[model samples]
Target chain A: MKKIINEPGKFVDEMVQGILLAHPGALRTVGDDLRILARADAPVSGKVGIVTGGGSGHLPLFKGYVGPGLCSAVAIGNVFSSPSSQQVFEATKAVDGGAGVLYLYGNYGGDVLNFDLACDLAELEDIETRTVLGRDDVASQPRERADDRRGVAGIFFAYKAAGAAAERGDSLDEVARIAEDVVVNTATMGIGISPTILPTTGKASFDLPDGEMEIGIGIHGEPGIHRGPLETADQIADRLVGAIIDDLSLADGDRVAVLVNGLGATPLEELYVLYRRVDEVLRGRGVEIERTYVGEYATSLEMAGASVSVLRLDDARLELLNAPAQSPFFREVSA
Target chain B: MRTADLNVVARRALADLVGYADELRDLDQALGDGDLGVTISLGAGAVIEALEQLPEDATAAELAKACAKAFANANPSTMAALVAGGLLAGSKTLVDSTEPNQADAARFVRAAGDNIALRGKTQLGDKTILDAIMPAADALEAGSDPVAALDAAVVGAERAVADTKALQSRRGRASWLQERSIGLQDPGATAFLRLLQCWQAALHAAPAERN
Candidate 1:
């Protein structure tokens, strides 16, 4: 309701404009309609294109991941809405380097439908396309129906692995297989301490009383599995890490990458506090931390919450995760 | 009714949709992201604007195609995409008809509902828009007069909207709420009901002889 914007209707467009302006050297708008964001040097000849897309409210996600070692392009949509199939096709066309393209994205229904439609369109143009859906949010569905789970911050791991593989000139099937493997090995759980207001409606998507926390809520403020009084940072970390570890069946001496992602409004200091607990919990369980990302990697629009994602890592995944990548939002130092 | 009349009816339905946008937003806020109202209105506005550029004598299929493109382009939300897919599918049923009658209207509604179900992968009891749209399509199929059929469809949709309060969502964002989504009207279903009511009202407001 109270935020910085010229017009609620133009929020997504203006945001895209700002992002392009801020990252002029790294990103550019593509497509006939200019609805897609691609890496400045997209269409890398012979390299398999990696593309992802979703609704707009989540920052540093579909768009922010478009770069040298991340997604080659992203089809952008309105806030909390999927991009049109035409837009997706444009992104596919913009990134296709003749080998093929892989569509990596969350498992939301809208994204699924639009991306599937785009694949069909791309087929008409003789461009091969494969899809790998990210379903790593443990809270959306039970483990038995893991395919139905929503993709949260855990998708960041998939992006890294797939992007690195593609950047190394891996074939589309190989890149997609690697991405799917990452999706299967990753699990994420989030806790919402407060609700966010939709910009257009200027109303809270949902209500959370002053002193309550909802564990397992999605980025859109969907109701979580459990709602109760707010707990301490350690307790919150225990619940999130405990759920993810249980779902993943992580054993002692296992190696994993941890990402403590802030949901837009949470402060970095608070995220680090949560990450500290996550580190302590993993250490106590004998799980080796291969790498750690504690920051606002993916975000909802000003939602006060955080999510913890753990990627069970093997040597190949670790190698890819450590590969050099640079985007405006995500960066991995060359090792 | 004449094929030209379809454009007028679509315009009226869009106006009603734009008018009820805020109400739909409030309903969605209870169970899902509160963007349905704006998304639907934006889609409708695009359709209406596109309709303005169409020839006065355009066939029902052409009109429906324009609406399909407009809705899909203006709003890419799940609900909007489903609606756009439905319109595209329904247009196929009217392709051969120069002036579709009540029977064609019935078939259009049924085809639209079936396409939405297929495209969205949702069924009657999924607590989605299909809950209202499927029943309304059936009701429309049972009647011969356009006005009466629309009236029947509206009643059926209204009942389905109320019925959704007792059902749990199994599709789209509302499904995330699980049991908590119970007792809240499915926003997509409510919007479908409003659309039917708007169409019925448009049918009634027109001259009776043409219908």
Candidate 2:
């Protein structure tokens, strides 16, 4: 294509190099692997080394989550791919202190295979490791088989809680437990208006008829369960929220942190429209909205869709989520 | 084509195909983000690099395996993995000592289609690369010459790409456009056609030098 690039083959390398150049004080590349972004002051002694890995293009999820009180390391794959096992292993070793390391990522097959391999490699290197996979996308799979669910933007909450717990001197085991707990309590559903292209293929991954939207599509543009004429923002919100409500089995008197995330191309106005309805639905159910975040917190490369994540929160979980934390992508309020 | 060295043909095909991706990215940005060039280029480069690591006497099968593994390791994007899956499927054809004499070529088409099905979860008439790919495979299975087969494949892919304008895209970013996707060729279909053109040229020139 007529674009400013030295070579198409080196695009990812160039992008990673540019990120390192721009954020010199905040991030550093782990050797030649652009996927592994580590903190400037890495291997924080006595602090559990928090790590996350996922496909790229959804910036700030795995990488943006890397900073003080968050991930100490992030292994970025190409868009919608998992990082190489070696890259994950290298990141684990780089971020490892005497306190051990926790490998937190999604539950995709490739990611599982590579990260599990990374764990094996890390064990050989004498780095104790724990793994936590986020399966929060209730739209993807049923709650009875939650492990089949895809990890979505709701993972930001997990990172927040796990990061805070690790920052406060929780051991690797404790951090893993916190992440698992967050995963268990979280449920998400997404609606799609448009499908995005994978940069390499220059083709759409899925299709929707004009004036129509698909309910419960997967992040990779896998076919959703159903397609229907486009509905109003409120109607779309009801469908998405209704799925979450049913999947999560929430009843009255429950409290949850809400995150309505835009999938890359959706406008702020539409997101607001969805959020307004989401709030109304939760209120009608007597479900307390303890916290709310509305933005492009996670995305598919320029896909016009949005997902709703509801993290059922308790007093202890609420305290950790609200704990003061700072990162280039997310900021938390102090308890 | 019978006397052609398959490895040399495959390598040239890959290198030339990456150049096509570089060209196709320009076309894609009109309808998609400027990534087809970058993604295909990255995948092809990884395959080329992996080829270098192969044994000097490596068969076409080993070469294909190496390309698949390397591309998976290097890029890990869904597209890369999908392409790698196609290559892996094609590689099995190369290792078959007893084929229907022309099964390698037929196998290539089948493998590519299988990868698309598994990775993208797309089907024919969805205005995808399969539009071009499936027809081309059918023509090749009828024993068309390699170059002619590839040319046919390119033609199929081009027609499929053009037809994408009328059909609602079943996948990718264009899916959101609905009928508004009219007037744009499917970029993936376009890229596939470009690769086939290069593949045709590489195979055509191979037999001439063998004599």
What's every prediction's RMSD, in angstroms?
Answer: 8.8, 11.5
Candidate 1's C-alpha runs over 4 A off are A32-34, B1-118, B122-211
Can you tell me which runs of candidate 2 are displaced by over 4 Å? A1-11, A333-335, B1-211
Q: Residue A328 CA error for candidate 2 (Å)?
A: 1.6
True contacts kept of 2: 0.00
lDDT of 1 by residue, A1-335 (tens): 78998889988888888887887899888854556988989899999999899998999887889898899999978888888787887799899999899999999988898887676456545689999999999999999999999989999999999999999999999999999999999999999988888889999989899999999999888888999999999999999999999999998999999999999999999999999999999999999999999998888899999999999999999999999999998888897
CAPRI band for model 2: incorrect
DockQ of each: 0.09, 0.03
Query: Clash pairs of candidate 1?
Result: none
Error of 2 at A54 (Å): 1.7
At residue A231, give the lDDT of candidate 2: 88
User: Can you give the TM-score per candidate against the true fold?
Assistant: 0.67, 0.61
